[model samples]
Target: MPKILKILQEDHRHHDILLSILENQVKDAHLTGEPDYDIVSAIVDYFLTYPAEFHHAREDKIYEKIVARDASAAEEIGHLDEEHEACEAFIKAFAAALSNVLGAGIITRSQFANAALEFIESQRRHIRMEESIFFPTALRVLTTEDWASLDAELSDTADPIFGSQKEGQFEALRQEIMDWQSTREPANDHVPGDHKLRL
Candidate 1:
């Protein structure tokens, strides 16, 4: 596989881990009467800000090229642009519903669960679509020259939650990811180094 597709799959794994944390919190909130609003807020903020705003935008840029190079591939995926928008919307709604906990129009835990579940399902589906279909196709079809152009266009949108430079706000999420990562085998477990085009 070309390095970019590998990097994308690694990104998907990170996203999956984060989503699992969010789901666990949602389950706890459902069982207990108290929700970890802070953790939930951090997660929602991270998703809306980083993955939705930055990652999806980067993918859309590559997707543009994918469509240009292979029209049939584009036809299969349809409008992933819309899927990105939908994820952000779902997260916003989830956050709003969580925020409702502190007010008169409090959403029940079940309602919050539904919203959270929807977001998780959507994200997993999107990732699976990319991993199973898009990544393989792009690796097979997208040229090194194509990746070079995309890499040139790619901005330095380093992840705030999982990047080298750890920012202040995402500390909890970072810890959660790190703690989860630690449990897994440490052999060759590095997040894919950012790809610098060599060809």
Candidate 2:
């Protein structure tokens, strides 16, 4: 596996954990009637910034090269860039909904819950598609030279949450990830029913 792919997979792992945390928080909010807006905001803020700024761009670089190397691979790749755009839109819309919830505006708990679950499920599905379809296609078709070119061309941007220089701004969210990781039993990459909420 190329280093870039490994990094992307690691990013997906971190994202899965965060999504689980978000799911747990959303469930709690549904039950308690009081949402932990700060934590929720932190998770939303992290998604809004990190994945767009660093993660997807890296994947796009690789995906572009794969298509150039083999046009047939394009079918497997299949609108991933558009999906990235959609993911960004998801985060932005979720952030706006979160703002409304925080302000105690017209957004109902049902609306907020729907937005949160949509973002979480969309993200999980995207990652799964990339891992299943995209990454394997890249590995099969891309030559050693291709990997070398991609490795040289790609920038080494440290992830804000999981990277070595972890940002202090994400301290609360980071702790939530850690606590969530510690408590959960080992499970498959695809967490079935994890996103289900009581509404």
Clashes of 2: 0
Best by lDDT: 2
Q: Rate the local accuracy (lDDT) of all candidates.
A: 0.72, 0.82
**Could you tell me every candidate's TM-score relative to the true structure?**
0.84, 0.92
The numbered model that scores best in TM-score is: 2
Task: Tell me the tens digit of each residue's lDDT in model 1 across 1-199.
Answer: 5445555666776677778778778788657866577777888888878787767877887788889899898877778788788878888887787678756776777887898899888888888777777666676668889988876775666777666765798877677666656564444222233222111
Candidate 2 lDDT by residue in tens digits, 112-174: 899999999999999889878888898998999988887887676787777877788888877
Per-candidate Cα RMSD to the true structure, in Å, reads 5.2, 4.7
C-alpha-based local distance difference test score of model 1 = 0.72
In model 2, which range of ten residues has the least summed lDDT? Answer: 190-199
CA lDDT of 117 in candidate 1?
91
lDDT comparing candidate 2 with the true structure: 0.82
